[model samples]
Target: MNKILIIDDDHGYRDVVSIAARKKNWEAYTSPTWRNVQHQIAEKKFSLIIADYRLRNETIIELLDYMKREKFSFQ
Candidate 1:
């Protein structure tokens, strides 16, 4: 199963994605807290990431930076 990470501050959106990922047999992890999300990425390896265009504490740029630094590709 592929691992997918979703970073969003919306509960409803997270739940919907979680359900969809499960249906596809993908492991999904979500966080409304940006700090936690970043920390998790450092410790876990995810095949794909689905981040919201906006976040409460961190912007898309921050996420993009992490992705770039980690050499994560769209594939």
Candidate 2:
């Protein structure tokens, strides 16, 4: 199964994405905070990561930089 990670502070948005992913037979995981998302990344391998451009605690650019430093690959 394909695993996907959805990162956003908006609960509704996460739910919507999760539901859509499930309909397509993909496993969806969500995180409301950057720290939580980071932990999730460390714990599992996701085929895709969909993140909000502006999170409550971090911007997308900052998150991308961190991911690069940590050697996390995402399309």
Candidate 3:
């Protein structure tokens, strides 16, 4: 089974994408903020990540940096 994480400040967007992913038989997780996203990433191994390019003021660069620093990878 594949696991997918969707990060977005918009609940509706996350809900829609997560629903679509779940319909495909994939496990879907969602986080509304960068802090929570990081927590989830540290707690779980995700096969894929779908995120908003810009979440409030924080950009995806922070997430990329965190991933690199932690050696996080898709599985």
Q: Pick the candidate with the highest lDDT.
A: 3
Considering only N, C-alpha and C atoms within 3 Å, which residue pairs clash in candidate 2? none
Q: For candidate 2, give the lDDT.
A: 0.85
What's the candidate order when arranged by decreasing TM-score?
3, 2, 1
lDDT at 24, model 1: 98
Q: How do the predictions measure up, each by TM-score?
A: 0.80, 0.86, 0.91
Query: Where is the poorest 10-residue window by lDDT in model 3?
Result: 31-40
Task: List where candidate 3 sits over 4 angstroms from the true fold.
Answer: none
Inter-residue clash pairs, candidate 1: none
lDDT of each: 0.81, 0.85, 0.89
Ranking by lDDT: 3, 2, 1
Query: Candidate 1 vs candidate 3: which has greater TM-score?
Result: 3
Residue range 48-70, candidate 2, lDDT tens digits: 98888998867878878887888
Q: What ranges in model 2 sit over 4 Å off?
A: none
> How well is each residue in 1-75 modelled by candidate 3, as lDDT tens digits?
999999999999999999999999999999886668687798788999988889987888899989999998778
